[model samples]
Target: MKQGIHPDYHEVVFLDSATGYKFLSGSTKTSSETIEWEDGKTYPLIRVEISCDSHPFYTGKQKFTQADGRVDRFNKKYGFTK
Candidate 1:
């Protein structure tokens, strides 16, 4: 391990802006924003646009072409029979 060569790693709060979800984790990223978490402790706040809570894949909200009759359209385009 090297000294004075590593970024500061500390517990920070990641806030999902869309879902307003927040989680505490350690990271080397620095932020100028601060937030008081439920633990009554102040930590750096990082706002993110997407997280597990708001991600389509993680939340199972992903839309597949199978549901919108795209297969039928494809079949018609290719002159294939059902």
Candidate 2:
């Protein structure tokens, strides 16, 4: 890796807003917010709307909707005929 040419990669905390789940990981993303991790260290805080912790599939709360083709859905929605 070349120096001064690549973005700074450092540890950052990703927060799932819905579930308040947090995990530390490396990223090039930067943020003004900071958070104290479980290790007693501070890291940049990044807030996200959805994560695996709160996602329906991961939580086993996913709904199995009847799969509808695009044409069928469009026609049904607009009442298209002929």
Candidate 3:
């Protein structure tokens, strides 16, 4: 590791907006936002659109959809060819 050439790494709070789930981890990502954590300390806050808390695969709610628009043979099999 080199000194004075690396980005500042520190603890950060990642928030899942959809579920309001928050977890602590280290990151080099910087944010102007901050939040008071459950431990009564504040860290850099970053909001994400999706996280494991609300992701479909992690929640076992993923929809199994057939790929239906790219192949002519697939369309024919589904009686969508004209």
Most lDDT-accurate candidate: 1
Q: What Cα-based lDDT does every candidate model obtain?
A: 0.93, 0.91, 0.89
Q: For model 1, how does the per-residue alpha-carbon lDDT over 1-82 read when each residue is reduced to its tens digit?
A: 9899989889999999999999999999979999999999999999999999999989999978676588888888999995
Ranking, lDDT, top scorer first = 1, 2, 3
For model 3, residues 1-82, the per-residue Cα lDDT tens digits are 8899999999999999999999999999989999998899999999999999999989999864544345666777789746
Question: Per-residue error at 21 for model 1, in Å?
Answer: 0.6
Q: Each model's TM-score?
A: 0.76, 0.71, 0.73
For model 3, the superposed segments whose C-alpha errors exceed 4 Å read 65-82
lDDT of 2 by residue, 32-69 (tens): 99999999999999999999999998999975554546
The residue pairs that clash in candidate 3, if any, are none
- Residue 3, candidate 1: Cα error in Å is 1.0
Looking at model 2, residue 44 earns an lDDT score of: 94
Give the poorly placed runs of model 2, Cα more than 4 Å off.
Answer: 64-82
Off by over 4 Å in 1: 65-82
Give residue 44's error in model 2 in angstroms: 0.6
